[model samples]
Target: MTTGTARTVKVLVADDHPVVLDGVTLALQRTSWLDVVGYARTGRDAIAAAARLQPDIVLLDLRMPDMLGPETTAGLLAGTPSLKVILFTAYPDHAAVEAALAAGAHGVVVKDVERADLVDAIRKVVNGERGVTAGIETDAGAVTARHGLGGRGITRREYDILRRVAMGQTNPEIADALGLTRNTVKTYLQRLMEKLGARNRVEALARAHELGLL
Candidate 1:
């Protein structure tokens, strides 16, 4: 998914609705930095198009005909670990967000997102950062608490790190902010994940928020 330094970012858009697919594809193409490489109307088509197009980023719809968001994301990453995926959905439920992130999706964006925000999400994920759309953290907190998954306490430092993560800081960015080495920050993230029983930063931060640790 790495492009030449001079090349525009290539993107593949997948949505079940034709209007959505066309609109998003056109929106992305309007940006000078982004190039729309392909479009898919189903999860099966998404996986196949991704394998063939090998785009820098994939804007995937959460609910699709064949495979769901997580399954499609997993398939894409399985074929190319370097590819970035940002799940898109109008529903925006906590379980869907959690599942998508757990399946290795780089981010999640609500379908109603502004064009600029959507573009930002694509850019962020391609840069190895995670995108958590509006209302997700709040929803996650509610879901985590409702499921009784928020009783555990995390260390102060872990709480600090998770807060930074919720603020959308990447590992290296967090390391610099906290004056820690990047590897140490990585280790902390691993420990934090284990402590929170989270598969990714989004889940860890959300769970921590639900526990009132952040």
Candidate 2:
């Protein structure tokens, strides 16, 4: 005996490009086991649709006018409590890929792939398989340490913040966990940014990975 979910997958299509959205939506709609629950043309809209639809998978584009893929990914995970997202990108940089996975995107598809890869990626994510990009170790922290991604000598508290942020914990959660005020957490985040040469939390996380502190 097995669950019906083993056969069917529900999908949400989100992209800044109308043509890509329409194409993916139409392609998925053709399958008996797949349904296109909603289409979104912006990161904010994607979060809204995913929250309402609670689809099994979300096809997310990286470059949106309103938000980049990393921020959009964080928004999706923040908004939709039950949806899994798969990043869709023309560029597959290690930084972007790592950010997406840390932000809870289950997989990534380069834009040039044939439609079949998209369909199959949806199925894989629905089956509770994290479709990781090749060569990334699951142990981001250990990898980071081994590679000496540490810089400017992060303090223990900063280390705590970096670890939590890399694990996808928001500032509020980090604050609560560390028994610090949210403002304090924000300050620590800023300190980490300057020390690591990162522009923001996402950049910091990626930089950590690059230096092997991930």
Candidate 3:
């Protein structure tokens, strides 16, 4: 929550899909602590609305017309540094989610998330906690238990690199995308492979799939 007095958390919902936009707006409006302030169909519209409405949080869709969630998140944060963003997506792609988080999103929730879970996540984020998937583990211990990684869990950065590898991106491309040097990317890749007990990228990806990391 922002400093000062306690008050309703104003939210702006942005989604290209009309059904989802309306449904989410209505659902959020039912919460006494949250007020749905506005709606937007495109990322540009979202940015404009956030500026005009000065909402406390923006429930942004992952894939919007004109801009992606992470880009929109960056724009919103640049304009209003105090505003929080929670990404709403049907596809929880590890790379995309990590990219959005890196862009300053407070949390990521799946589209099919239960109303209670969504509300809890929103409240948690507003209360200064990192939001996570509804039924997924966000901590290292839980991740290790779920993935059976022998007490070693894959990190966000490693998962990002792993996802890129699964997408068939070259190391240089991954480095450029992540703003890392080629050598740094190589080092991270090597470390991730070792964690996965794989000899190369192909084997690493296979191991990741077996562990449901990909």
Candidate 4:
């Protein structure tokens, strides 16, 4: 499934399970725009293959030998700043997923996600969209505690807006991207700033980074 031009998207898939690796690779290979360049069974191997292959995107499993999704995501991004990562998990562990997101994962998708949704998510993420989660329920309390947020915790909406702000998106752009009114975006931004004890967008992002919520 593709739109517009015929540009090919090189992809590297990393999964410990051979069955899963093969299934995902074959499925993605069926898509005209996606090229499955390589596969890895461990986080370290994924990192190595990503560096060697230089794929545009990495479909990484949430649990792998040597390292978890968040750690691997951080390592991959540190090595290849231009690579997009999508965390693929059988279980929707909110804390872990939030950590991966904070570590700069482009999106998270359940293992059972529909092919169409997965394709859409990759496309959206490649288009610079953040917080692309599919078939996973986010727990605000779990994410708050994971990042050491006490007494005050941000809601899902606030977190979404915060990520967009960190990406340097304007309020109007955020509103359009999230399908929300500008006033609603403003309200969420205000609440996020208060929760982070920041006076402005820049300060809020700084505080969020200090708190490990970004």
- Maximum-lDDT candidate: 4
> Model 2 — which ten-residue stretch has the worst lDDT?
132-141
Global local distance difference test of model 2: 0.71
lDDT measured at residue 69 in model 3 versus the true structure, 0 to 100:
63
Pairwise TM-score winner, candidates 2 and 4: 4
Q: Kindly give the stretch of ten consecutive residues in candidate 1 with the minimal lDDT sum.
A: 140-149
The whole-model lDDT of each prediction reads 0.73, 0.71, 0.78, 0.80
Candidate achieving the largest TM-score: 4
- Please identify model 1 stretches exceeding 4 Å from their true place: 1-5, 134-214
Off by over 4 Å in 2: 1-7, 133-214
- Taking all chains together, each candidate's TM-score versus the true structure is 0.62, 0.61, 0.63, 0.64
Worst 10 residues of 3 by lDDT: 140-149
Write one digit per residue (lDDT tens) for candidate 1, span 1-214. 2322466888889998999988898788778889999999887788889899999898888767765666688888988777888888775653345556767887777778788888877776766676455425454335534443234545546655665676568989999978999998888889889988889888886876565443
The true-versus-predicted C-alpha distance at residue 6 of model 1, in Å, is 4.0
Per-candidate RMSD, Å:
12.0, 6.6, 6.1, 11.6
For model 4, the superposed segments whose C-alpha errors exceed 4 Å read 3-5, 137-214
lDDT of 2 at 153: 75
Pick by TM-score: 1 or 3, better one: 3
What lDDT, from 0 to 1, does candidate 4 have?
Answer: 0.80
Query: Which runs of model 3 end up more than 4 angstroms from their true locations?
Result: 1-6, 135-214
**Residues 39-156 of candidate 4: C-alpha lDDT, one tens digit per residue:** 9999889999999999989999976766667778988998888999998887555434666777889888888988877888788777787878777666422643654433457876
Ranking by TM-score: 4, 3, 1, 2
